[model samples]
Target: MGRPSDIPVWRHIGEAPCPPSGQERVTIAIVGAGPVGLAMALEFGRRGHQVLLLNRPDFISAGSKAICFSKRSLDIFDRLGVGDAIVEKGVSWNVGKVFWGDRPDPVYQFDMLPVKEQKRPGFLNIPQYHVEDILFDAASTLSSIDMRFGHEVTNVLPDDDGVDLEVRTSLNSYKVRADWVIACDGSRSPIRSMLGLEFEGRIFEDNFLIADIRMKGDHPSERWFWFDPPFNPGQSALMHKQPDDIWRLDFQLGWNIDRKAAVAPENVEPLVRAMLGPDVEFSREWYSIYTFQCRRIERFLHGHVIFAGDSAHLVSPFGARGCNGGFADIDNLGWKLDLILRGEAPASFLETYDEEAIVTADENIRNSTRSTDFITPKSETSRAFRDAVLELAQDFPFARPFVNSGRLSTAISYPDSGINTPDMDRWVGGVAPGSPVIDVPIGNRWLLDRLGNRFVVLADGWQGPAPDGVEIIDVGIAAETLQLIRRRFDFSPGAACLIRPDQYVAARWRTPTPALVSDALRRARGLA
Candidate 1:
């Protein structure tokens, strides 16, 4: 990998050469300082808990890694107070075009943002390094967050009451006792390995070469995908424009190629030049070859030790599920851990985090596996079917659904979660009890912006008193906006919804008594 002079580098205030330290005690210890680890530290820090964030690298990070971030990710970042900053620097996009062979025009095109009038765009493309920099900067403002950049965890030993960790630096090793430990390391998690856990899933045989090059590209911000293109025959290709004049390109390379030689500058130059055209000028910044895999550990929570982000699950880069899924993990686990720490919820409450996150990981695996199969067919019959579907997808609306470039990451509903209060009334069209809340505008502000990180009652002129400690969010708006909210939330007169701290609906009803709302609140807190 090569770094250009254009990209900015970030150094943390706590970054320094490693020397020995004395033993210490902390409330929570988070391993890894990538986007997920830093976000995890921020999640706990904002909840008024002391956290120790550890990373192996001296600097934040470099190169073009995990650039595509989904809408759900933006919402999480917004809650963390860095959403506006990310959107300002990222390349926002909504439309995507799919091409077959050397066709002059795209056979089918689609909009990623199906719903209208949302606060954020459908997707944003910014280098992963920028995301880490922003998250670290936000975490620095919190007194509860203590970040160490050049530290590594040598061992993790869980006892009856808490976990003891051995941390190593350049000169010496020291111990830290933590009531709770969070693992946010990359896919190759050192924490998971030390705990003797293993992932279970399939690793696809196909390979893809990624090339990030700088150039004055004519391509629009929209994502462009091609199948069996002339530049790379019998395979698929993808292209996206980043914030800088950098263009990211991916070319399919079958299983049996030399991984080392494939990334050589001499070999990678021809591929980019051929794809761009004979006269195009460009400079390469990075090149790599990699395989795809969909795998996850069986459980995310183990006693006082928990795993999140790439350490918990992994998905192919096609749908941008990698980092987006990580944000989802933080959103789900943060509130639950906060309640448990305060003794408001039992230890068993953390098990739900294990269940819900596994559900999310499994769903992403199933959908991403399907997309991989469509992009890289396994046999002649499958390839023929895929091509036929692509041919008909251009004109036939029916065939469009069968074409699986990627399912594009979305917030999944947890219908079977134990904490969800099952709906007791008939509903028409609204966010369900276990679904993610829909974003709507209220006056000049967005609906989500008003709902802070706490349990609230979203009522529609219900006049019913909410349970203790639960606040009622304002939904009063202009007639047009009110109508939109009513439609999206099915909030007829007297309808009420109970939303959890993580912005997920716990329960809803058309008409409810005070007793019922109390029961739902208790149930959502894992006390019922």
Candidate 2:
């Protein structure tokens, strides 16, 4: 019942401040202990930099916020040694079904996506807590990372040297200084607002209510998008399976209804009963009313104070990109901050964090917006077009992509991003300049499965030895895997590609050319 901050550190992962007697200075102070902040804290600590991770409420959120994670995000988590536990507990779902208005069954069930080759986990549907628990545990293992919860960041004052943060505990307040400060706060970020960064975007008129309920209904295990639930005349609903036999259902409640009244338990039950039928047993796990808003800060990093996750941008939860997008932010910013703090790379490397991340965040915002547009069309004419397309898509393969506008497998790429080769051909699949996630086999293993750690170059017909500092796996994969790579990746027999550490295509060539390969690796390392 006493101050939570008064608790000793070793007793628990308490938010008590490190005694101010030493006035300990650190390289970076990361604000917010959500997934993004925790990821950054781990990355910086791994680089041997002093880090202070601050968060409030002193606990992991119990509700499951995120619905899906991408293969690339899984790979990053693998490197950090946290993705394994999450992979074990969460369900792996690669397929999704799309339904039309009042349709008894889905018209299109998409199951085609390139699988990662490593024994590491592929796409997963673990709740946000599972990821946070792993990350929090990993952060605790690091002596360099001081995980402080219950420390409310009351102020962030930035300067040319570094930022000064005022963190208030129940006992007292402490002033902490660091060379860098990262704000991983959510959409209504105080740090971002203090910097005067404009969050530019509009909100969709439609509102929705989401409830996690246990239902033994007729729904498939895969992700489901009902274009128009019969009970909701002009709206849509998304229902998907989760761990522990729970199902997440999101229903559009229309703009005419009051946001406050729409989320009442009494108001929500009818929608669920109508969709799942009266015979099914149901119990609520959690519920929330949500509105679609798409916005991105103009810059991710302002001076020495940086931003990540919802602090940088806010995307609708339609594509399961909201939290995963923030995870990507940490993955990108982590290594860059590591390099800068270790003096391996100039702080200029940090600049690319803003450039590359903002681009990806903006793209995510746009993609989420597109999904919202499909879910809630603005005009009657647009609705008619969507209806017509849904009808046509019932039988046509070409119209399926139009009706299913969201591309879930789209990997994060920065073609003009200082990290990649400007001339690399992006036509082939796999994580190329413009490539989405595609299946490629390495020996008997899949290319995506085996791609972890350093950059990799999977060359089938190398006339010469592989380039220096590149892992050239010519025969590490099965012949079938190689054949799969050729068929799906469209690689020529002698084809070669330079994959970045993050598993994105840095450069590619029909043949293993030394100069291009070397330059691509160098660029990926940011030496260029």
Candidate 3:
């Protein structure tokens, strides 16, 4: 078979020099060059921290492994300086339609981004390799990042102070030391195995076949899912549009089927022809069979070493939680690690990353598990109930809520966390402490852009002096801006809210005072 014209060739870069034994110290060491690892390098390097990024393989990825990038992931990419490039290259959409049986029309449809005005779309579909390329280009320009391709970490030893890693290459073995080590080496992480960590969770019995085919067609750019369709017969399937006329098709194979035979062209081609008509022309770009699982480690933080992305947790692909959840891990850990390295916060602050990420992992696991259960019923009674809900959803509005093809991934809010200050003000319908702030327009700029990379005090009609490290933005002076702010923050004329560096609300007050604001700032930074 000839290679597709659209696929990019992987380039082989030469090996990097092995560091000396005695003087190989750095601030942070990141293992893997995938999206999550590159994100960690970019985030820490942007803040002027010395970062060593190591990758085992010398060549770039060939296929689109993960296609969906959520809005929260895009926002984090924006902060890392590659958001615009990614959005420009990817296909953006927020609508999804679900079909049951041989129906001529969709039984139900949903809009992910209900609000029209926002900084980013609900999600974008781009080849995972393209995202890694963009991140690699950005990381190359940062002087603080030391990128070492083809150097695999053979051993990781963590002590009370820091970690020591033994890296192996084609020519030589070297020692590297770092104050902190982040394991983003993916689901089959060598670092996790080297430390003898146990990842506890359940693996589903169902297997799925994923195929990426390239063709030119008139199909709309939205997610289309079918449950027990006529073309497949007693199986569920999903179809999604990609950027370069490449479409991703997923078919569920029962536990009894042979995985190798199912992915063979003789079998897969017939299914494709049946679904898209016999006359349609398409070429296979990539194909693979995978079993779904939901799992996470006991804790993300271990002494001087930490885990992020697939190294920390794994979820089924139904909710787009795998990559999106990894991005969330980077966002949660980056700022706190930066503060600790700079002595702005205590070392105990790192514990918050563990506490927060565990809760987030639990949330992702629960959602993914529920979606999987609905999609693949283990018992006859469960299957009947699911079918009934799908059948009724076509006509009744109440039944639409019960229809759970797959709950799309959204940002999870942390309302009751130890990091966020307790509410001391009256608010109705807006972001609370520990919740992410919804993006709103301020004049010609965005409210998030004005927040910058530091703590901020957002108030309406303020007449007092601001703190030293905090930026104060007065929103009540203009009618249009104030109205939008009020609607988004549920603010009155004199209300003020403290926002963290990652754009999460830390505290809110009906009346602003220097003492109270300072206390909130200190508590938010782990000074309390």
> Who wins the TM-score comparison?
3
Per-residue CA lDDT of candidate 2, range 1-528, in tens? 123453223223445654565455678898887778888887777767889888865667666477687766776677677867778777777778887777877777775243444454346777777788888888888999988887878888888888888777778777888889999978888777767788888888777788889766655457777877686666788877777788888887887778777777788888888878756689887778777688888888788999899988888887777887888888778877776666656777778888888878878887888877777777899778878888888788787878754556345677678776765454545445523335455555555557654567767676545566566866325565556567555677777776655556667777657777877776666678
Error of 3 at 90 (Å): 0.2
Looking at model 2, report the run of 10 residues with the lowest lDDT sum: 1-10
lDDT of each: 0.86, 0.73, 0.87
Model 2 C-alpha lDDT versus the unseen true structure: 0.73
- Can you give the lDDT of residue 389 in candidate 2? 81
Error of 2 at 398 (Å): 3.1
Ranking by lDDT: 3, 1, 2
Answer with 2 or 3, whichever has the higher TM-score: 3
Q: Write the per-residue lDDT of candidate 1 for residues 191-242, one digit (tens) a residue.
A: 9999999888889998899999999977889998998899999888999989
Clashes of 2: 14
RMSD of each: 2.8, 3.9, 2.9
Q: Which 10 successive residues of model 1 have the least lDDT summed?
A: 1-10
lDDT of 2 at 482: 55
